[model samples]
Target: MRKSRAVMGNLLPFIIAIIFIFPIIWMLFVSLKPQGLGISNPLKWFLPPYTFTNYVHIIADFQVLRWLLNSLFVGIVTTIITLIVTSLAAFAISKINFQYKKFIFIFFLIGLMVPGEATLIPLYQIAQSMHILDSYIGLIVPGIASPLGVIVLKSFFDSVPKEVIESARMDGCSLFRIYYSIVLPLAKPALASIAIFTFIGSWNNFLWPYMITFSDHLYTLPVGIPVFNSNYSQDYILPMTVNAVSSIPLIIAFFFFEKQIVKGISFSGIKG
Candidate 1:
């Protein structure tokens, strides 16, 4: 019974993974189908008449490359800024003792409960007032306020030995030095997790960029792809092609950072 249970435990995760990944696999196959062929029949999707025609047409006709570069830029910038801000905030919350520290930590926790959609109107007004609309500043700046990263990193930081920090202080290490040298090195897994999550979120973001950006040049992949699709609404292959293209970066990111993701989430859970 124990052996059977163990086998079931191992098997369950694979089953779940397949369930999640199956759609992406289907989308890839559908994207490869000739322009008019895949939409009518689902079963014919995997059949042998595949070509790169859709990819070629989309790349040549649309601003997809520019959109791709825009998404990459925003995602990378957002991830970097979020890591720096959240790590510093997390370090302060975890290591430094001050009045109302618990209150400040709880304030950040409350931010996690607030839905991002709720802030869109205010954010839009603020961006409009600041004249940052239709710019990279609008796309990248708002996303850096990451409560989730602070929460995750704080949990991991809590797991670090207080004695080590004290020793560093005793040895005349400044707070910034301890944070830069000791805390960050120990929090690599947590930071990696936050970085991946931030990048993916920024890359996949459609609504904010769509609302803020007026120009095609400023549009990110999620927003830009749909504009491309609107013109070719009847064609299934083209939509799938853009989706596949948009997904490729994220897929590559996950493939390379899978270990870091798992390790980070595991550490967060255990430490939290």
Candidate 2:
């Protein structure tokens, strides 16, 4: 009976996953269908004749390309910055003994607990004051130091054996040397997880970027989707196709780091 319950629990989630994926699958199908295909029953997407008109047209659309490039740049920059800031902070907090270290860690963790909306107005005002509105720095700077990244990496570091760090220190390794060479390599799984999270957050960020970046050229994927849709006259198929393409990198990252991703998340919850 216990085995049966475990099997049911496992199988139930798969059923739910398929149900969730149905809409995405349908959207991909509709993107393939030409404008003439009847959408009265949208689920009957496979019945229509397939064409690359939508994909080809979207490819020709310059704004989508521009938005993609902007998002790619911002996301890459944000991810790199977030990883460095968070990792160094996490490493210091985990491995070092400084006065008020706990206070500082708690301060950074405040970012994780609080919703971004609470800080949006102030962040906007600051951006305006600094004349960074519509600039990449305006979008990227605010998010470079993630509280969750610090918390996640800190947990991973806590799991590392202390002896290794001691040995490295005895070998005349500086604190930064030990952190970069010894600690980070063991926490590669956590780093992979952090990079994925940072990339996804930056790629999908619309509200903050929208609030700050007024220029059409600076829009990221989420904000860009709406702009593209407006031009398409609510012809969602083309925009959704472009969205699917943009999601490919995120999806590929998940696929490649599936194991590390799972381990990094689940085990991080288990403290030393």
Candidate 3:
């Protein structure tokens, strides 16, 4: 009975992984099916009629590369800006004593309960008034002040040993030095987790980008893929292919930094 339970425990992760990954694998297989190949039986996808035509046609016909680049740029820029601003704010709130600090933190926590859609119209108006609409600045600026990012980093910062911070202070280390050198280095796992989540959010964000960007040139994959699908409504394979292409970057990112994600979540939960 003990041996059976141990074996089941070890097998559980593999089972869960297969369950999660099965849909992505199925999507890829469906996308690879040759054009004109009807899905009379889903199992037929395993046969010899697979072709690269859908991928080739989408790449050659659609501006997938441009959309991909736009998403990549927006995602990376948003992640970087979010990390920098939130980390500094978190460090100050977590470590440095200030009047009304608790109130400020409570305000940020309130923001977490507010749905993002509730502020879209106001944010859109502000962007329009600032003349940043249809620009990269418009795409990148709105997501920078992430309350969740601040809260996560603050929790991680709070978990850092107070002794280490005091020792640095005694050595005449400036707050900036302590933040850049000490806190940041210690919070790598949390930072990595936040980066992954922020980047993915920005990349997958469709409604805001769609509302803000009128020009086709500025459309990210999340916006562009749907447009492409609508344009080629008759071609079922093309949409799937485009979707598969759009997902590659996210998959690659998770594959490389999955460990950091797990570690960061674990560590952040320690104090929060």
Candidate 4:
């Protein structure tokens, strides 16, 4: 019984992984099928008269590279800004003593309960008032206010030994110096986890960018791919091809940062 349970535990991850990865695999397979063909039959999906025609057409016709660059720009900028803002905020909440600090942290915690979709209208109005519409500033700015990053980083920051912070203070280190030199280094795993989530979220973000930007040139990959699909609505394979292309960056990011992601989750689970 014990051996069976242990084997099942070991096998569980592989089973879960396959369940998650299967859709992406199916998407890629369908995208590889000849352009006009639909996957109405599951058996015909693998028996592909496979071609790169859809990829070639998408690249030639659409602003795919431009859309990719736009997404990369937005994702990178959003991640950097979120990391900076959330880390500072988290450090202050976790380490600094201030009036109503608990209230402030609780406020951020409340932000987690508020669904992002609920804020779209107000966020749009704010962006409009700022006149950042149809621009990268609009794309990148609104996403920086991440409550999740704050919560994760604060949990990690709280785990940092108070003794080290006091020792730094006794050494005449300022709060900024302590944060920059000591706390930030200790919170690398949490930071990595936050960064990955922020970048991926920004990359996959569609609604805000779609609603804000009117120009085709300003469209991110997620937004752009859908627009392309709208024009070629009858053709199924092209949309899949574009989706497959768009997914490449995220897949590469996950694989490269797989260890950091695991470490971050483990550390957060243990510390938090």
lDDT tens digits by residue: candidate 4, 86-186: 99999999999999998898888787677899999998998899999999999998899868778888888999999999998999999999999999998
Residue 214 lDDT (model 1): 93
Worst 10 residues of 4 by lDDT: 263-272
In the predicted model 4, the residue pairs found to clash are: none
- Model 2 per-residue lDDT tens digits across residues 45-136: 77758888987877787877788888889989998988888899899999998999988977886766677788888878888999999998
Residue-level lDDT of model 1, residues 101-186, one tens digit each, is 98998888787677889999998999999999999999999888858788888888999999999999999999999999999999
Candidate 2 lDDT (Cα, whole model)? Answer: 0.81
Quality of model 4 by C-alpha lDDT? 0.86
Candidate 3 has its poorest 10 consecutive residues by lDDT at 263-272
Q: What is the TM-score of each candidate against the true structure?
A: 0.83, 0.85, 0.85, 0.81
Clash count, candidate 2: 0
- Summed backbone clashes in each candidate are 0, 0, 0, 0
Off by over 4 Å in 4: 1-20, 34-44, 258-272
Quantify all predictions' global Cα lDDT against the true fold: 0.87, 0.81, 0.87, 0.86
The per-residue C-alpha lDDT of model 1 at residue 29 equals 87
Task: List ranges where model 2 is wrong by over 4 Å.
Answer: 1-16, 36-38, 41-44, 260-272
